[model samples]
Target: MNIEFKKNKLSIALSIALLTNLSLMAEEKSPKELDSVTVIGNENSDYKSKEKVKLNRTKMDIEDTAKSIQSFNENFIEDSQLQNIENIITMSSNTVYNGDNHGRTNDISMRGFSGVPILIDGLKVTNKMAHPEVYNFESIEIQKGPDSLQYGESSPGGIVNLVKKKPTKETLGKIELEVSDNSSYTPKLDVAGSLNKEESLYFRLVSVLKYDEGWTNSNTETNKVFIAPSLSYDVNDNHTLTFMAEYTDETTPSSFGTYVNSKGNLVAPIKNTISNPDEEFEKTQKIIGFDLDSTFDTWNSNFRYRYIDYEGDNGNVHMPQSYNEATNIVSRAFASQKQEFEEHALQYTLNKEIDILEFKNKISLGADYNKAYSKLDMFYDPSTPYLINLSHPSYEHLTSASEHSGVMDMSSDKTYVESWGTFLQDSIYLTNNLIFNAGVRYSESKPKNGQRSDALTPSFGLVYHFSDQTSIYTNYSESFTPNSQEDTSGNILDPEEGKGYEIGIKQKLFDDNLNLTAAIFKIEKENIAELDPDDPTLSKYKASGKQESRGFELDINGNITPNWSIVASYGYTDTKNKDNNNLDLKNIPEHTANIFTSYYLTSFGLPNTYIGGGAKYLGSRYADENNKIKFDSEIIYNATVGYKKGRWRANLSVQNLTDEEYVDGALSSNARGTRVYVGTPRTLLATISYSF
Candidate 1:
């Protein structure tokens, strides 16, 4: 027989044997309910989440986990009307909104580290150029510090995991429409139901369409379409499979926001843009994946696979090079790029619980493999200088690749990366009050054009429970990230390494409805790729730099009363470049705070009505590595009123209640002046939703 045929024959034989065994086992076992689907909504629709699934590759109570984990459920996302992942960062601790990189990347800084990885479920998203849509996700989980044991080759700062909505056993449907003051309209649909009377097979479909006119004077319109469908099948009482697919197509302005002059003052109005009218970014992403869960006599196993295809086109982007404040003229260069990325990932995990030496031990073992290929085609028009008078900007003279013609420089390249890892973990219940956890992972990364790197990372933790409602924990973890930069000698540098230490306390009050946590952490990173001080040309880099970040964070979430819910966070971060005379890191705020609370009007005889308001404070931050330019602290306020009766719900939200003028993020600074992102002005959004 042919090799391919032989493989297929073997697969079929294995499937048949497995089914036969399951059938025999079913005949001998008693009838039981099928495994429950993961639910995102908490009891009473509260803001707090009781458990996290991605942290350990298994659902576990947050109080029992040694790491610092924060969860925002669907209720919070709906109440806040979060549009994307960037909005969720504001409510998190020790995080900075680093602006979407001209609507091309999810630029964010977590715990003083930039470029944190984003995951769907437990798998990494290879393409980071597009922002993740929030409508399809049921919850967002932020895992602080190094989590390399579960996720390989990630920034030590943290990882963000988006939990997707799953098929429900009961028939349900929801329709919603939203209108914003900025001439934006959105319609969304969500439906889920069981396919059979036995409820063993189920399906869900979610979709959203949005159109928004330009918010600024420039032609910065936005359009988006997203659809996701999923299915869940129970092969038997001991096995389950879930299939998921997603499609997204979106276009948004590739705006650089406002600019700052030499005197550190904003040069343009909040609603004005310096970008060309025709500049825009477009992206289309598609994903298909499946998960298999199995329970054997002695262990439980999970297998997952995902394939992703992404394409992005960034139109002509104007990059300011130099600004003459006295002449009121800004010189810029133009560039356009198109990227294509495809990725395939596979993961398998097994878990078992047993007693060793009379001590209860939960052991977990897993392996994962990921392969990705990317191609980039770029065109630059640096030879043709494009100058614009900021005092009276005109788009007629804007330069694009088509305009430059023969003067443009073109380049194309293709690259691929293959990575694999295996991890083992054990959680030991030493006693009723004390628990110990240990894990180790061995990972390897091989790039098509770069050197191969491998590492063995370890994590250790201890948790002590004072009572059922209070606990204290400490953890130490290490992270490894392969480096692609090269020195002047054209040699790839060694991988970056990180070490993190944290201690925290957790408390539950109000009958476990309210959860509070406080943590202090220190992170040390080495082998950072930085500009070679010796390389005067600024074209080479060296990986000899080191950095450190130490911080304290406090988070509170849940209900103060049956009718009152609150979510609050505060962080104090101190970061320094150990190799650069202890200079403060750019855009890393020293103090950040947020608080949002809502109260139902049940006492006022309107149980269906609620009023909520909150404020976000971003502390002073430096715009550059030299710390010569600083941005003052700013506080923005927001409010919302919501009412629901029967199957109908309505909400009105007002953002930037005071029309605060502030810098949301600093992208970069140079002789051309500072490229800063401005905060959104006062805006209103109204939403009406119906459920059946």
Candidate 2:
């Protein structure tokens, strides 16, 4: 069947069902008025948000939900000046910034698991290599542990969801410019307001332009452009419609940094680059989506649809394969690739609050469908090795090479994946201070030219509120990810399965201004694909590997006083491969911690001035699965000062304050241990903004 035709058919069916539900809801009689529910937290001190949107596909209070969820609001994003997803996620407990795939992907890991999926407004986008820009987001939410009941075929670790800024009825505008010591400049604009006299139609526009000269010796430059526009229309008192679109174009240099030598030491200086300076990676992405929300006398419903298109071309790629310390030469491969990805997703959810057997119950049910297509074409000339002398690097390689002296190998792959799932959950209020949460999902996945996989996942939780300021909870959940890889016999492997268990406690402190949470969790995954021991060439694989991760985390956020704001977290993780004599997982730190605090100077007579500072620490980790090579730990510090008065605001930030030289993370490591990444050097940035 034609892809477009199939999509249209599904869309039409979903639309008709939505209309029918709306019609039925309209005829229901009104019920007794319920007490109003108020959202907590204020704009003045909002490092921590009290509510989350994607945890359960509804705006639920964090204290009432029996899950470990962390949220960073707009105030924190602006105060810290975080630009990318990597910077934002590292602040959360048990999360690490894995090496960026040489400017290709925003690689990250949580609880010893990598490749965690990212979502925009509770919808998945298939382009994992494109890093999400944070300029247009209102908040970032991270749900820890398996969440297959809400999102299908996701990593067992967790999921990151970005809530976009929407159009508002009141006029608001802001323009800002920033310059950094590393020869980087950025300009941004945001405007939102009502578009009609009745104040029922609203529009919002957000845009950013960024340019940066290379920070390393290779002088690899970067340029990026991002724009987002959205509209909201109040069709009636009971219904609203919102439409949004986004476009992004970017070009960045690929720097793989240096590798570990035979002596198990870093081969090059922190500022040096091993890749050719002329090579570049280009990417373009576009998204279009719409959402409809309806409220009736007894129930509420939301329908959302999104489509994403992404393309990329990596030119003249260089990958380090091995290093000879005796000659100070690194043997690398010359390669190139192109990739295209597209995704279409639809979701509908309904929620109702009712009295069952004289007890209040909140019921939620939803269904979702997603389809994605991806294609990759690669070219390599490994016979003609590119040798780089670490002592004296050279950038005189071919500017554009389609023909080499050696034989060139080319390959291509195309894949199509479609998945659908339905889930139902309920929160039963057994008593005024106790609650029980249970949910289940039926999920199925079908891949072109691959086997079909299905699973039934269930979750159970209980929350007990000791008082208005204290609570304790425990939960269990399961997740599954379909596998496309085949064995030596051409038989598809079974999907990977995971199960998680967690228990946590929450407490409100300092007049209910600060929220504190501590939790312990254990997760196990089975059927992980690994190389077959009997396959000498290592070209074939089996799906019999098993791994486990156990960890404890502590987090605190919010205000200590009216003028003092803080965010802090610490996590310890232990991961082992059950199939390999309990070896440690590669690139996963055992300990991680972050803390940031800011205070207004009102008491010191500078009412509009503030100062903030923080430090991030990553413990030592192994470079390879065998744990033969270990990388040392490091701490990076940052500080900021800002002044806001009238319509003008100014700020200055210093990153890597002590000019720390350290290995940030690694992408991959073989017996030779290559593809390591270096942390950023000391840099200063200043910004000026005007608001109306």
Candidate 3:
């Protein structure tokens, strides 16, 4: 019931900003918080005076570890203006982001599971059917279970890491302007630098551009471009080096077609002016990544590389009553679909920080290699309008007859996959309050057509420290996932294994400006990737060994009162379908929660106005998999208004403030027609910013 009001609205607004930043960092000891952690950071910056973080050193951290996790930082994305990453990734609390006609692609799920796996900076830019974004992030980690030991045949109910954004000597940067009413326009730029002369060389660059006219009718729109650059070097005093690069290209116009279909699926029957699908689905992907690091004293070394290519296409039915219901059965009007992906990977790691015999050690070792390729293309047009009447409930899609007007000529193909890996981890302290962690990973996969998947995953953990504020931890892990790129006659689909358990607790009451964490998790999966009793319609897919999930999480972040702050979260899920306990695992959701608070009246007198609000709850869902059909549960609210001075800032935003229409993502009533994508009905955004 009301999920315990997400823990009394984040423990009473973080017990009043954690007793006012613990009485101002315990007064008289602030050199800007030790000069923002000693003017610079690295070696994960000794975890910056740590409070909770060390999910296997950079697997990711911000709060307590082992399952159920979340973080936003950067003062909750500049006090919630949340510059996209799909709006702070649904503000965690059991993530979900429904809409996807597959343009720039967006479709995710975490507690209820849906191939959830994404990483950047930690690599593995997801894809069994791609969709990635977080537009050059600098922090954003959210996990829940079996974090696939952090991606190894991944996705066991959670994982989303998008770190990027390195290179800092603090020349802090920001610049922006935006407008929306469905006639979008945006421009943003960021810069940072501090080179040589002991600044140890550093650099940062971020850029973005957008154009829109979306909210459709028949010539839809959404265009984008992005660029990023990063570099850091410290060559001596222990040796160090790093370099990174990014590029993005996006084009949108095809928001999936076959227009409106009342009872079979597909909605958005025109209510705005734009493209009605007349055919146009475009996608372009290019990414080059690298990072090399070295340090000596106790040992640490690194290497990572990435390359990706994405492709796209479409013209299918394009609306017009789905081209008059597939051209009345014989003269096909249009149809074509395409998909492609390519990737190359490399990884190397080594770490050691020992105190040996005295009993204090930290060690990690790694190895990796990967090569992948995928492809698909289909077309139709049996006479021009295609042969409809197959129990005609208004059929649609049918074209690509080699380019239209031919009947069944083109159908491309391609698939290749390979992989290798090794890993080991350790972190034991035993005294000073107890600390322990363990790990193991081994993977080997091959796929030309199938067979040859090996795995060895293991993990353990513990962290006590009851007093210096608080602490408690536990972890158990195992993971695997590999298999995709065969189906449609080539076979191959079996490699989805998982096992995980976690318990957590962390607190810093008062001092350290507030931070709390609570977690519970469980995961079980096998084979995964479903549908194939022999011919589940032909595009062929299989791998269902079973599946399972369980969860609980709550997190509240920093600076409760130094000026009022809050970053909330909540999640409770119990996914199923492990050999039909009553089948229903299509869209997932048991209960989800989210809340974000803001306070800072400029010392209360309200100078340059600032106010905040947030609420989100989603439950009751099941729209396929023998559950029949359903999707009735919703709660949403958000509000914000702000003003800042000195470097200039302004804002106004209101989203789904109870004007909710719902359907954060939908599709799967046995598939084939009746597409849907909705969520974002009451929107009004405006922005301005500057910093030099």
Alpha-carbon lDDT, every model: 0.81, 0.80, 0.62
Worst 10 residues of 1 by lDDT: 33-42
Kindly report which residue stretches of model 3 are placed more than 4 angstroms away from their true locations once superposed. 1-69, 72-141, 144-152, 155-158, 161-179, 184-212, 215-218, 221-252, 255-313, 316-335, 338-377, 380-449, 462-513, 516-556, 566-599, 602-692
Give per-residue CA lDDT, model 1, range 1-692, as digits (tens). 86434533443454345345544543454544222223322223488875555646744467667988888887888887756677776688988787776766777777888778888887876774456778888888888887688778888888888788888787666777788999877777787889998989999999877767757776646777788999999999999999999998877777676677655567766665565666777889989999999997667888999999998888677766666777767777788778889999998998898899999887889999999999988887666667777768776545667777655556557789999999999889999889899999999999887788888999999999999999999999988889888899988787899899999999998999998889999999899888887997898899998999999999888889988998899999999999879998888899999988888898998888888988999999888888888888889998999987765788999988999888877888876678888878888999987655
Over 4 Å off, model 1: 1-44, 296-298, 317-319, 397-400, 534-539
Return the clash pairs for model 2, or none: none
Per-residue error (Å), model 1, residue 659 = 1.5
Q: 1-692 in candidate 3: lDDT tens per residue?
A: 45334433443454345335534543545656434332221111011123232233433243323445665654466556554564576677667766564454556777666666666656665442233334356566666666544347776666766666678876655666666788776666666767665788889888766666666544535555667777777776666576766666655666542322323232333333112334455666776666777777778777778877777755464232232234322122454667788888887778887887798767778787878887777655545433333223333433334555455646757887788777777777778677787878878888776677777888787877777778888888777777663565666665677777778887875566666778777777787676666875766776765777777877676656655667777777777787777466766777777777766577767756677878878776666666655667788888887777665677787777667766665543433333445555666778776554
| TM-score of every model versus the real structure | 0.91, 0.91, 0.32
What does the lDDT come to for candidate 1?
A: 0.81
- TM-score, cand. 1 vs. native: 0.91
| Candidate 2 C-alpha lDDT tens digits along 27-48 | 3425431111122123244576
Q: How accurate is candidate 3 locally (lDDT)?
A: 0.62
Clashes of each: 0, 0, 26
lDDT of prediction 2: 0.80
lDDT of 3 at 568: 70
